[model samples]
Target chain A: MLTYANPNRFMQLARRLTRPVWGLSLACLIIGLYMAFSAPADYQQGMTVRIMFIHVPAAWMSLFVYTFLTVSSIFGLVFRHPLGHVAAKSAALIGAGFTLITLITGALWGKPMWGTWWVWDARLTSVLVLFFIYLGYLFIWKAIEDPLQAGRVSSVLAIVGFVNVPIVKFSVDWWNTLHQPASVSRFDAPALHSDYLWPLLVMALGFQLLFFALWLLRMQTEIFKQKLRVRRLGLVETSNGTAS
Target chain B: MEHVFYIGLSYGVTGVILCLLTANTLSAFFSFRKQIDDEFKPEDSANSP
Candidate 1:
């Protein structure tokens, strides 16, 4: 991993990876959607259960991407790897996108199942806070002119905000929220039957792959921007040297 | 059948968001790559034998 920390090498690997990752993601999404549509409707929820195919995966990705951001921020702060900052910075918007999808889909799912579009419950509120934290992290980067200072500040913010992740995860369990507790993840067998379980797992895998594809592309863009800035600075220095 | 609208809307919204994010990232990637290439064009041509 450290050896591939160099931006050029990372870009090479990313270029090689983007195509296969995207292909697999597309395949999974198509098959998952087909299975989701074909599966028998839940005896209780009926057709609305199809919403779970998207909602659960988006919710999973919201937490997963934040964890990615937190780990990348830690690498940036502790290891002082330049790529870590780039990775952390690039991941913010993608994470926010997933978070937004989670919130919106959850609301859509809730309206049909729980008879409400929105609720101020523990699980819902914590995820909302996570969304705001993402926005704040992005704003810090844009507001600070110096990349180093921006990176330092946002790294601290990400690390500190990571406490909310577990709270978001266990909120349903700890509190008497309207939200349901863990189904797919449990010590015992999953609560969901195989019909729904398979499609949900496939969709989750597709969403995760899609996140990686976007993250890689964004990181490449950031590296290019940094290179351009360095080149422009070099040109300015050269012109100044000639003038003097 | 009555709940079909809600289910469709959920999938539609998620699909739209994912598509937009993917498009935006790819667009940015290409734009930045072009800028970098244009910026270095002079040096590249100058180094040619």
Candidate 2:
């Protein structure tokens, strides 16, 4: 793992993995969609329950990506690893996109089931706060001029903002929310039926694979951006030397 | 069913959003790669036959 701390080695690994990971993600999504559509509808929610196939997975990915971001930020701050900041920066947009999908799809599911588009419930509100934290992290990166300073500031935000993640997860249990408590992730056996459970798991796997594929691509782009910045600086220094 | 519209809209919106995100990430990746390649290519060409 430490061997990949070197950008050149990491780039080599990323180039090799990006295509295969993408292919696997597409394959999983196709299979997962087929399974999701074929699964029997719930007696309660009817066809509207199909929304869970997309909604739950996006929710899971949104949380998962933020956790990933926070961990990377920790590595960057504590270890001073070169690629740590790059990894955290690369993951922000992808995490935010997943969070957006979670919110929109949650609303679509809520309208039919809860008879409302949204509520100020604990789970929903905390997730919304999480999304804002993601946006703020991204904004800090853009607002700061120096890379090192931006990395340090945004990393602090990522670490602090991570407190919301567990709060979002346990919110339903902690409060009497309209949202149900954990169905598939409880310590006990899952509340979801095998029919819904299987397809949901497949979709979650697909979402995870897609996140990895995108993360590598974004990290590679960040590395190239860093390289270009250094090259431009060198060029300016060389011209100034000649002028002097 | 009556709720078919809700389900359809959810999946439809998700597909579109994911597609757009994927497109944006790919474009950014290729754009940066191209810039870096161009930045180095001149020095390579200048040194070669």
Candidate 3:
């Protein structure tokens, strides 16, 4: 872990991992989709059960990514890990994208089953709040000019905002929500049948891979931006010295 | 099937958004890489010492 604190080493690891991660993601997605379509529809939900392949994995990623962001923020804030802020900031947009997918697909799935486009159910509302927190985190990055200050502010916000994660996860169980409770993840045997469970896991893995691939690319970009900033500053200082 | 529209739209929207995000990230990456390389080219380094 400390090895990655060195930006050059981190860059090398990112370069090496990006292509393979992407390839594996594509492979998993292809297999996952095939299995999803082939799986039998729920007797109750019918054909609409197919939507779970994409939707459930996306919802998982939404929470997973934010948790990852929070961990990275902790590293940055507490340990002053150099790449920590870069990792957290790079992850924000990708996490937001997943959150958006979760909301949109959740609504799409909800409409046919619930007889409505949306509701203020505990599960639904908490997830929406999670999305807003993601947006707020990104806004902090954009609103502040100084990278160090932006990182500190956003990291603090991320750590504070993570309180919503547990609420979102437990909302279905804690309240009489229209949304269903955990199917794939639970203390007992998963609620999903093997048919749905297998492909859902595969798709979830694919989504996770996709997140890492994108996260690496975004982090490398941020590192390059930092390099450019430093080089420009050095050039300015050199010119000033010559002028003097 | 009536459910087809809902399912199709969901997948379609997901695909579009992921594609756009990928494109945006890739472009930003290349643009930043180019800028950094430009700032530290051979000529600039030769004059450093």
Candidate 4:
């Protein structure tokens, strides 16, 4: 990770990796959707449960991206790696996108499954709060002009925001909620059989790779902009020096 | 048919978003590389005393 901190080195690797990353992502998506659409209806939920094909993966990505952001922020604060902050910020934006997808798709699934468009249940509420945390982190970045100060402040928020993740995980167990308990999560036996499980896994992996590709893209953009800003500032300083 | 529609919709949205993102990334990559070259281009010649 630190090895790629230098902007040039990061760019080198990102450029080389983008094509293969995209290829694999698309391939998985094609095969995953094939399986998802071909799989039989649930004996219980019928057609509505198909939304899980998208909802589950989006939910996974939302939480996963936030976790990545928090870890990256911690590294930035401890090691003083500038790229760490860039990675964290880039990841925050992508995480928010995934969070939005999770909420929206969950709502779509819920309307038919739970007979409600929205719920204040534990699992849903925890996810809502998690979404807010993502926004709060992004807002902090924009609200402050000083990146270093923003990094410190948002790093704290990132660390604190992590508590919601476990709540999101355990909410079903802790409360009588309309949201279903963990089907794919429990270590005992997956409630889902092979007909459903494989497609879900494929979709999950596709979403994860998509997140990485986007994260790298965002980080590379931020690094390049920083370089551009530095060059412009240097020009201004040199002009001022010559004028004096 | 409804299930097929929903499945296609999901894949469609994902594809569109990824395509746009890829385009955005390529443009940025080319422009940045050009900037790096431009910043260093002037010193490459050998004619000046």
DockQ for each candidate?
0.90, 0.89, 0.83, 0.31
TM-scores for every candidate against the unseen true structure: 0.96, 0.96, 0.96, 0.87
lDDT (10s digit) by residue, model 2, range A152-216: 99999999999999999999989998998888988889999999999999999999999999999
Candidate that beats the other on DockQ, 1 or 2, i.e. the better one: 1
Docking class of 2: high
Candidate 4 chain A minimal-lDDT segment of 10 residues: A1-10
**Model 2's TM-score against the true structure:** 0.96
Off by over 4 Å in 1: A1-5
lDDT of 4 by residue, A1-244 (tens): 4534577788889878877887887788788888887898888978766778888988888889888998998888888776778889888877877777788777766666677779998988899999999999999999999777888889989989999988988899999978888799779999889899999999999888877777777777777777777778889999999999
- Candidate 1 lDDT score at position A149: 92
**How would you encode candidate 3's per-residue C-alpha lDDT over A1-244 as one tens digit per residue?**
5533599888988899999999999999899989998999899999999889999999999999999999999999999999888999999999999999999998999999999989999988998999999999999999999999999999999999999999998898889978888877788998889999999999999999999989999999999988778878888999999999
Ranking by DockQ: 1, 2, 3, 4
**Least accurate 10 contiguous residues by lDDT in model 3 chain A:** A1-10
Error of 1 at A186 (Å): 0.5
Residue runs of model 4 more than 4 Å from their true location after superposition:
A1-5, B1-49
Interface RMSD values, listed in order for every candidate: 0.7, 0.8, 0.6, 2.8
Model 4 interface CAPRI class: acceptable
What candidate 3 gets wrong by more than 4 Å, as runs, is A1-5, B44-49
Give the per-residue lDDT digits (tens) of candidate 4, residues B1-49: 5555544555566556557656766677678768867874674554352
lDDT of 1 by residue, A1-244 (tens): 5534588888899999988988988998899999999999899988899998988998899899899999999999999987888899998998999899989988988898999999999999999999999999999999999888999999999999999999999999999988889899999999999999999999999888888888888988988988888888888999999999
**Residue A234 in candidate 1, Cα distance off native in Å:** 0.6
True contacts kept of each: 0.96, 0.94, 0.82, 0.14
Return the DockQ of model 4.
0.31
